[model samples]
Target chain A: EPEVTQTPSHQVTQMGQEVILRCVPISNHLYFYWYRQILGQKVEFLVSFYNNEISEKSEIFDDQFSVERPDGSNFTLKIRSTKLEDSAMYFCASSDLGYGYTFGSGTRLTVV
Target chain B: SQKIEQNSEALNIQEGKTATLTCNYTNYSPAYLQWYRQDPGRGPVFLLLIRENEKEKRKERLKVTFDTTLKQSLFHITASQPADSATYLCALVTAGANSKLTFGKGITLSVRP
Candidate 1:
């Protein structure tokens, strides 16, 4: 089965530093998404991308965060200034219409 | 505000028994509900999906029931084993099919040998 791939399985960064997380979504899937799961908390939707642009975003996705489909297969999320609260597991997912999403293993971001 | 609730924080069951997980939602009408499983330190893996028009759906030993009127969904795994032990999350989809989901905190299941 095809899989979504996320890079830097684990990352540790100092607070106030910039960080970029990358994901390569399934080739044929049209929709891509970024979600965050804070330790001991529910998974939260950060943003959804379709047609190479952001289709929707949640309040948690503020000015400090942005997403890009930088290429045919790469989708990336960038956090301009990481804060301690920004630490979480970031997941990337993709899906075809009316189908279940295929999620990547996720990248663990730890902001110190 | 939309809220999805999986009441039990954790559950323990013996092997070869059925494990049933409950999910309830409020302040929203979903077109379909989905269930996913997550192991420690991993992202959720899709398991099953039941639409509002459908009351019940099943796959192998797994079964799911959606009660639109009751605003709830139940997930069941029959003849479960230790490998089935994990955190299960229930999510609600409000818009078109395969859209962003609002997920519950999830319930952890521990199957004893």
Candidate 2:
């Protein structure tokens, strides 16, 4: 089965630093998303991207966060500045027809 | 405020038994509900999806029941094995087609051999 791929399985960055998390969704998928889960917390939706534009974003997705589909295959999430509370597991997902989403293994971001 | 609640306590069951997990939602009109499995330090893997209109859906030993009136969904794993141990998350997708999935905190299931 084809799977979504995310690089940098784990990252540790200092506070106030910028970070870019990269993901390669399935080749045929049209919709992509970024979600985060803080330790011992529920998975929170960040943003959804379709047609090279953001379609939906949650309140938690503030000015500090942005997503880009810079190339035909690569979808990236950039955090302008990291805060200590930003430590969490970030998951990238893609959907072809929009019913089910295939999620990558996730990138663990730890801010100190 | 919309909230998705799963069984808060972890479920422990002996092998060969059937395991049933509960998911309840409040203050949200869900068009579709999905179940996912997550291992330690891994992303959620889709297991099954139940539409609002559909009452029950099955895939092999796994079965899901959706009750819109009750605002609850029950997920069942029959003849369970130790490999079935994992955290199960129930997610809600609203009426909007492109809406994001709002996930529950997830309940852990442990199947002992």
Candidate 3:
């Protein structure tokens, strides 16, 4: 079965630095989403992208966050300034016609 | 405000037995509910979805029951094996095309062989 794939399974970055997490959703899927899980916390939604534009975002997806579908196959989340609280597991997901969504293994972001 | 709650602790069960997990919510009515499984350091994998109108749904050894009246959903795994051990999450989708979800802090299941 085709699955979503993400790059840089784990990343360590300095506080105040910019970082970008990349994902390649299923080829034929139309909708894409980003979610994050803080250690010992519930997974939280960050943003949803469709037609190369943001459909919805949560309060956690504030000024520092941005998502881009720079190419047909790549969906990237960029954080302008990383903070200690920004450390978490970031997941990418995709869906076809409102059916179940498939998620990538996730990228663990660590800020120090 | 809306809140979703799952048992914060892990559940231990013997192999070949049934494991039942509970998810409860407050202050919101969902159009649909969904369940997912996640292994350590992995993303959640979709397991099943049950709409508010439907009382129950089942797939293979997994079963889910939605009680909109009680604002709860029960997830059951029968004839479970050690491989069935993982954290299971329940998510709710509000009314709208955008359909953003609110998820409970998952319940971890540990099945001993």
Candidate 4:
């Protein structure tokens, strides 16, 4: 089965530093998503991307966050300034029909 | 204020038993409901999906039932094994089929052999 790939399985950064998480979604899938799960908390949707632009975003996704499908293949999420509360397991997902989604292993972002 | 809640935080059962998980939603109507499995330190993996109009759906030992009127969904795993231990999440599509998914806190199931 095809899989969505996320890089830097674990990352540690200073609180004020910038971080970029990368994802390579399934080739045939058109919709991509970014979600985060804080420790002991439920997974939360951050943003959804389709047609090379953001389709929707949650309140958690503020001006400090942005997503891009720069190469039509690599989907990336950038946090302008990382905060301590930003630490979480970030997941990347893709859907072909938008009903069932395939999620990546996730990248553990630890903001110190 | 859409809210989705799983039955509990954790459950443990003996091997070969059936594990039934419950998911309840409020303050919203969903087009479809989905269940996923997640191991420790991993992202959720899609397991099954049941539409609002469908009563029941099955795949092998796994079965899912959707009750739109009750605003709930049930997930079942029969003849469970130790490998079935994982956190299961329930999510719903708040709008059309193409909408984003809002997930519950998830329930952790432990099948002891």
Query: What's the lDDT of the predicted structure labeled candidate 2?
Result: 0.94
- Indicate the docking level reached by candidate 3: medium
DockQ of all predictions against the true structure, Cα-based? 0.74, 0.78, 0.76, 0.79
TM-score of the second chain of model 2 compared to its true counterpart: 0.97
lDDT for B89 in candidate 1 is: 97
Q: Write the residue-wise lDDT of candidate 4 on B1-113 in tens digits.
A: 76999989999999999999999999878888999999999999999998888999999999999999899999999999999999999999876535788999999999999
Window of ten residues with lowest summed lDDT in model 4 chain A: A93-102
Model 1, backbone clash pairs (residues 3+ apart or across chains), number: 0
Best-matching candidate per DockQ: 4
Query: Which residue pairs collide in model 4, if any?
Result: none
Kindly list the per-residue Cα lDDT of model 3 for residues B38-97, writing each as its tens digit. Answer: 999999999998988999999999999999889999999999999999999999888774
Chain B TM-score per candidate, please.
0.95, 0.97, 0.96, 0.96
True contacts kept of 1: 0.72
User: What is each predicted model's overall lDDT from 0 to 1?
Assistant: 0.93, 0.94, 0.92, 0.94
Of candidates 3 and 1, the better by DockQ? 3
- Cα-based TM-score, every candidate: 0.98, 0.98, 0.97, 0.98
| Residue B61 lDDT, candidate 4, scale 0-100 | 96
Cα deviation of B15, candidate 2, in Å: 0.6
The DockQ for candidate 1, computed on C-alphas, is 0.74
Q: For model 1, which pairs clash?
A: none
